[model samples]
Target chain A: MKNNEITDITPKRRLFELNLGDVWKYRDLVMLFVKRDFKNSYKQTVLGPLWIIIKPFLSTFVFTVIFGMIANISTDGMPQFLFFMAGNILWSFFSSCLNGSSSTFIGNARLFGKVYFPRLVMPCANIIYNTIGFLINFVMFFILVLIYMFTGSNVHPNLCALLMPFILLSSALLGTGCGLIVSSVTTKYRDLGVLVSFGVTLWMYITPVVYPVSQVAEPFRPLALLNPVAPLIETFRYGFLGSGTFPWQYLILSFVVTAVVLVFGIIVFNKVEKNFIDTV
Target chain B: MREMNENCVIKIENLSKEYRLGAIGSGTLRHDLQSWYAKKRGKEDPNQRIGAKQYTKGDTFLALDGVNLEVNRGERIGIIGTNGAGKSTLLKVLCRITAPTDGRVRFRGRIASMLEVGTGFHAELTGRENIYLNGAILGMTKEEVTSKIDSIIEFSECEKFIDTPVKRYSSGMFVKLAFAVAAHLDAEIMIMDEVLAVGDMRFQKKCIKKMRDLATEEDRTILYVSHNMNTIRDLCDRCIVLDHGKIVFDGDVEDAIKIYLGSANENFRALEYVGNEHKHHADRNDLCLQFVRYNGKEDSNLSKKSYHCG
Candidate 1:
């Protein structure tokens, strides 16, 4: 018998009580939530997962024509299609994760109100689900790269290509961290909910998703790297398409900033989870 | 550690939950900011009473007030109360679905709550998938649900449709499947809130029997909230009656029900006293509603306007 098991409920929980152990114990529930997301997201739809592929494909083509041709944005001397696809893959991954986690509380209020599992499970499940979506997008990008390579393109994926996993982890963390903070605040002041999607759209313009960081004026280049996601996308292009600079200091700063944002997000999220049922 | 009884499986002390009477945070950030600015300038909140402080009596609704309780192992406790009298709030706080505004609750073992059946079930998921999802939400691991899947399917008696989506199932079938999953929960403490209100009469009896066996054989502690006096009498060894966010009675089942109905009759009498001309009309209407709500079997007499029974 598990005599040592016990649980206490109180009006207030400590600020740092993240309950990571409970999240681990409820790992099955997290997986089930992820599976539910997968099943329900595409259910009864004819196109289904094809939408995942078509979305980025269409966006890539649009960016290639609009920015690459009309605006004459420098892709740092890379093919317009590949340049847009690489940036599209990383940006979409981070933004989707951010948008999804941003609505975690409001989206699952019914489930959270009736059950007692760790509240972190919802955000964690979303991060995993969005990661799966991100991976699919990445694979499509990779296949496009291979087709470009076979057709006599000058693209060369370097040793930096191995950093794909690390880049992905940091980006996911950053996105969910910011999303969690927004989710927590929206519990009380829902005005933020209306602004989240719009803010993410505006945020993309400043992060060099369509245009390379190299195109930024020299004076403002450093300022651009200060945005944590800037160096992530830059490094992603640097590795995969071999077109962008490898600023190691900016990448390190990006990771440190990601770690801090993620920690702060989780703390705020934990604080709100205790009583969010009232406000949400 | 606080002093706890060795046999007590659940303990709640000075528990209270207060909710703002109106929209949360005064409805908008603009109003919240206005209130904050007013407070900073040494003025009363513009959104609140002219001279009243925050959380004043009129500003908040006390859902549960200073409730203290303890339950030993293998006890089935029935909680009865009028709507908004805090029965559901008590179960919610105990389940940790919502935080209490004051005090604390401690439990000695694993607690599984069915605040509502099919709590996390997705409409698109099949009955089998929903069983797994619902079980996981109730704190069961994948292996635990896997082991009990067959028994759950058999208990629901919808084996043929187990693979079909729950959205396609009749409401009765859905409740049966959901209850079957909740019935198979492996926990030392179970908190249920009127989960058997749906489904056929035979199924409700079967569920009550299942809960009884769980309490007797497995020594699980159960805290059940229901308005049905018969079920309370049939299933509970102990009973609690709440009135206006306070525990008016807690004792043997028969005595608790007596106190509950006694007070209910008094409330009706008070209502009748407030209006003399419509006394007879109001009395019959209230009784008919109460009969239909609290006692389904007496619904046959709902048509009788002169029906008067205490």
Candidate 2:
């Protein structure tokens, strides 16, 4: 009902008035952003959205060769191609969220300086756009899953597979939450920008992407498990490949960490949004 | 209280915005921490943050200070100021793009602004797509934009290139589309800032006429900022002249313009006098140098004289 009663804007607003309700009113803007992101990212490229699948496939090929053949990384008895494909696809989804949203403020300084809307929409749209790429890349994933099944391999996608979307959502939320914090920080200290992109690469190494949790020894093993993304990726592998551990406790832990991180990101982001135009 | 009549759509009271000049913040984390520590210790902020200092020297400034204004529905108010007079800053605060450092801005109805042309326009998106995107950014729903799509294209005069990516369009074509989209926003209050400077004279006239219609027929409130006095005088019924972020004059368009134009000539005269500033106290050699060997005159005929102008 307050929608129609004049907006009173003051210098000192409540720090935590997330105003998600206002975001829903601008749903059309978010859709346009999704559309714009797709158009801009895919446009002019010769292959268009085909680049979505091609990118993951090429990376998977490289990852499988280097980690599986050269270094002989473990895939938990699953085919190297299928395992790397899943890992690359899922890891990309999470990293893209981080990489994309982390620069949301710096990348959008011009647009943000001119207009007003829920600042969250920019990062939210990033996740959605990346999801589009992930889904297209999902086709490559599905085909690989089918290929292993037809060959009578040990790729048994189980009922746990139903949880894949939810797990991916959690990873996206976790990445976006962390990305929001980084985005706000980078606006002040640009050094973080360089650190984050580099950190993400190091992050993928520790998340058991190229190897399985079972292959890591005890001390390093627990460290990998402590990575918030580790359990989600493990759950994803368990769901889609039926070979990884699935402790509900870890999943619950991942969910809680994601919830906390997202709330913190929003709080920091909300504070940054008010005066960022000055410092940014 | 009278300004709060149902007819009034906007009220800005005791509005002030302070900005630290040289480099925003303390330029480094140590200084930022020092500023925080200053606040904690109940000491004067070493950062000298907030509060507008006179422009005579240093970086701190007030973009707006204790400014108060009210506009009734259907009023077209022109805001004119020299660069950095806070015209754009006030509009930015009005649009909620940036929060004011102090005071409040009250808006009775939805407001859409053209802070700049092609604000969110991406080069890769087609002109048609940008129309929807821009409209949505202005807070229009899909159904509303779809309904106006045809008219928008016609108004922009980019019918043939509607499907083509905007990157290929000339700057003029882009502004036309952007202005057309802004024109279609049905909000009760509209704010514009120097965006009309784009495009040709004929299109500018068209836009002025449309703005007239919007104010008169549509019963909308308009706040416009422009350096073009002709557009301001021709379109706005009232004017506010801003000098160093404060409204020096707020009244009838012609009178406010007279004050604005008067100050401008004063500034020009002041600048003209600035050329003589160094001469008033020039070093002896800089005072007057008469070139030698001109017209076969010998070097011995050269003259160097010093005379203080003041």
Candidate 3:
């Protein structure tokens, strides 16, 4: 194709065109980043990857004391420990994706300044690595669910549990979308970095992670459902505990919103990736 | 004489890049506020008009301006210029790391650049992992990278510590691994920017040999940028000399160096070099004479040996 013709395509369409072909082409590099993040995450730590389990376990325990016992928050008839652990695991995944993707541009500014690669690859690799972390955390959660089952709690395993993969993927897409947008803006106006850290923390309160959606009386119920993360977590809790309210409409809305945000994120990200080295 | 039928791989037409002078910080805020006050009074902003005039003064500079050039496939082209002559900027634009403010650059085939050592390496990863990572960053497929992994590790000679995190590797080993990964990238156009200057002489020689083999055996288009004139003279078939953002010479390697050294005379008086927190004349004082101004008198040139010190 001619040079002008090449430049004519929008960066969004260009990124979609890049897809697996470009990713596969750089598969070795992605693995390197994955290896780097994984190895570095535990390097010099006394317990190494065990900290992965310990971190979420400690958070769940602390939240159960503060929110479940102290605040007396209702858990939609599920065991307090299982309820809090589920929320903690899901929140960790979403927050990690947002944090990882948001820092993608700034974190790699040195490499970006000197080299040319699909800038998308850095965040993509981060998501993959963080997903591995999520998987490890999920296994720990699974063990907890087994313990709850033996304790005479009503923990039914439904066929719908098979859809947890799709739920996790949706959560990842939502996080990636939000993260890319934040990263793109942060490249120009660094104030967004500070804003995102506080913003994501406040965002968790709105999601059904700490409390059940049914507790939010009617008019505010839809408002809580508007959050894409709310549906993903609710679905996870529903598939396992068979207690929390699951609205298909909200799930569809979440999917649609995730797709749109992802497209917009990629567009802005592609444009910034081209010349951010200069400005950054 | 017949026209050379060698296929051109890269073409630049009237390329230019402009950078704003002065610190782009609080100074801009004061200027903006002053302009706003002037506009409120229904008068032209005095600072705005004065600022425009100051930019037009000779003090302002262009990094690269209306430079046109071409490189044929399999040709080793050396770009030689003083610091701030837009050499790195040109390479950045060619590699798509930065965009030209104006004009166009057209190139065929994939381009792989090793502009800086350890460009894509993550210190937390092992040497073997970084090999794959850096390979992918250079745009190689996993299968393509897997096939070359053994050779890359062999070339780096760090197989014993391949699984050790790169943060633990010695700087020399790090450079070797980074260079090996860069060298193995399968690209039609390879751009190396002063990476040889940092490593030991033995490794530098190895890099030069690798570059020469790539150019001669693989028929790759190579653009080598370095201040080491001897390396440029020995390796490049043709050279392009850049001065004050413009191409002053584009021809045989030897002739380009001559023109570049010759043009250094016009700018010598105004040139300033800051070295280790001290400012000094860029030109050698022993080789040049200070101005001998006489009202209404024509300037005269003295013989090279008889020239007085500045």
Candidate 4:
């Protein structure tokens, strides 16, 4: 599809057209919502923005102690703390976007009912805020790596690290696509909310966050790779830790799935946004 | 009709919105299951069987029914009605926030509606951020909002708190900023619903002035819904009176107010007040109308008799 021709004309198309130009026109509103989410997420807290660092900091510490120390998990030549932190930060961003976008309609029903802005702006804002949080956490992870290097622990920094932002974007796009689909469905069927909360948690295990993809058994490895997030996370870890197996085929598959899901998400989101206030 | 078309920017015809208020739990599940079952059976809905009581009395209500009206460009129209008279619902339909169930509304230009102050505001956002946000939500482009940002903040009188999170703002300041963004929105048609009631009297005066200026100077169509009859009279060139989801009167401001006030007077008379029964009657007819009080000594004449109408 061309850039300008974003609309799909189906026979089942409802009353109104979904105008992407309107969404583009309302980009400032999207930014404001992003700012609101960023500030309100940590406002009134004693730690303030430090909570962004502290959350993944503590989670990485726990994972390093339990999975790296106690279970003696292999870090594939990279420092255990750095290895797990990278995975945690990446997964945290994706999960946060998913959880936030999934609740978009239900969370803002009052505002949605009173206003007529493109509802896509809410989820788009969520993706932007989560990306910022991920960037902050990523910076902290890098600082921790430098600390480990100063302490004489072996750490290899590779050129692939430059690809971190692209990986983050891919994950965000995937998360946003899935999140919008869930949010749109949840507006009509409230059960989708309950199901998604549990689904995301289970999905994290299937993605290779706790363990390296190399550890998965033979037959199940292909099935695990089939999980769209699995390849994205694997690629992110490979870019950072320089350890995980990066299959180009699975990467292509993940990109295809992300695009398809995103298109479906936008379609469903646009459809629901028009009249979801009534249904909600 | 041709002459009316020249001035009119909005024409709503046969507009009706229906809402189905299903019974509590079992009814929803029953309807869902029955619909699914009927779909599988490849037949018409069994629930639509003859005399099935498709809707119970308490379960259904029509918010609007066959409402038709025309609003002209550059005309300041005030929609006045009592609560639940579907004033807000009509605006919602026109704004396309909610679709009409059975009719169409044809609008000639972009519509910006302030159904309530701060409709999509996030308390955590700063006033400056929210100005752009609110403007964009009202359908302005970022560039348009950026150009109008200074004027919006100036008009709102919220310069000191421009960078502060709106959560810290007092309710009055929040409303002021919200209304400012709305007022500055560059839309052809502006629909305001009691938003001027939020701020202080001075701010209300400023808002009314701005709305008046928009209608006159900018030649924008304005549709205002407010309970403030005096403000309506002062600000609007034309007015519409709605009663029971229908337009009872639509014309020049004076005629509309007269119809509205006349009906209100009748309603007030029908409502019995102790020791004030004869207050509302016109003193024209002696036999048909009765007065219960007289300031002077009573005479034997029927015109001088102080009698209450029975």
Question: Which digits, one per residue and each the tens of the lDDT, describe model 4 over residues B155-233?
Answer: 9999999999898999999999999998897778888887877699899889899989988998898999976666787
The residue pairs that clash in candidate 2, if any, are none
Model 1, B100-198: lDDT tens digits are 999999999888899898888899999999999999999999999999999999999999999999999998999999999999998999999988666
DockQ (0 to 1) for model 1: 0.70
The best candidate in terms of lDDT: 1
Q: Model 4: runs farther than 4 Å from truth?
A: A1-16, A45-47, A139-166, B1-7, B23-60, B125-129, B141-154, B157-169, B261-269, B272-310
lDDT by residue (tens digit), candidate 2, A38-95:
8877777898887877888889999998999999987889989888888788898999
Tell me, by DockQ, which candidate is best: 1
Could you give candidate 3's per-residue lDDT for residues B1-310 as a string of tens digits?
0122337777787888777675332233356567678779988876754545434335545788988887888899999866667899889888877777777777767888889988878777788878877877777767877899999899888899999989899999999999988888788888989876546778777878888898999888899887666677767898887755777677788776554543443334242232211113322321232221212122223212122211
- How high is the lDDT of residue B178 in model 2? 94
- Report, to 2 decimal places, the DockQ of model 4: 0.24
Residue pairs whose backbone atoms clash in candidate 3: A25-B140, A28-B132, A29-B133
Q: After superposition, how far is residue B228 of candidate 4 from its true place, in Å?
A: 2.9
| Candidate 2, CAPRI quality class derived from DockQ | acceptable
Quote the chain B TM-score of every prediction: 0.83, 0.77, 0.76, 0.77
What's the lDDT for all of these models? 0.85, 0.81, 0.76, 0.75
Question: Model 1 chain A, poorest ten-residue lDDT window?
Answer: A1-10
C-alpha DockQ of every model = 0.70, 0.44, 0.29, 0.24
